[model samples]
Target: MAEPSITIRDNGPYVVTMPVEILDAKGNPLTITRERITLCRCGASNNKPFCDGTHNKINFESQVSA
Candidate 1:
């Protein structure tokens, strides 16, 4: 396994790399299959944490630096 990395996108979700485990409020885990995943940051996703591309409509802004 590779060292996990998190990438903050420009006005978008936080891109996360696997193999990783994300826990819910009940201490359950989210089932992830993709090697890379996008998590919501704008707090607009119908599916919280995971992005549903709502930022584009709400005009959220944030720049990510390497």
Candidate 2:
């Protein structure tokens, strides 16, 4: 398997490309059926921990570089 990568988008959610196990607060595994997923960063999604395109609605702004 290739190493997983997490990419920070331009004012958007973090894009993850890899098979992963998502956990809840109690350490319970959250079901993820896809290798590619978008994680919420703007804290505006009705679906917590996942991106639901709410950032675009709220006009969220963030830019990070290495």
Candidate 3:
């Protein structure tokens, strides 16, 4: 099995590529059907943890470097 890869997008969501599961507050797994997932960053997404392209409308700016 391959390891997961995560990328922080500029002014966007956290792009993740893995086979890991996303659990909720109750420890229940969220239903998702995609090879990759984009998580919210600006805390203004209607989808909560998921990215609904709300950052672009709010003009969120964040660039990560290591």
| Top TM-score model | 2
lDDT of 1 by residue, 1-66 (tens): 667888899989998998879999999999988898899999999988899899988999999786
Query: Any residue pairs clashing in model 3, and if so which?
Result: none
Better of 1 and 2 by TM-score: 2
Q: Largest lDDT belongs to which candidate?
A: 2
The candidate 2 region of ten consecutive residues with least summed lDDT is: 14-23
TM-score per candidate, in order?
Answer: 0.86, 0.89, 0.87
List where candidate 1 sits over 4 angstroms from the true fold: 64-66
**Candidate 1 local lDDT, residue 27:** 92
The digit string of per-residue lDDT tens for model 3 on 1-66 reads: 457788899889998886779899999998887878999988999998999999999999998888
Candidate 1's TM-score reads: 0.86
Q: Across residues 8-34, which tens digit of lDDT does each residue of candidate 2 receive?
A: 998999998877777899999988878
Please identify which of the two predictions, 1 or 3, would achieve the higher lDDT against the true structure. Answer: 1
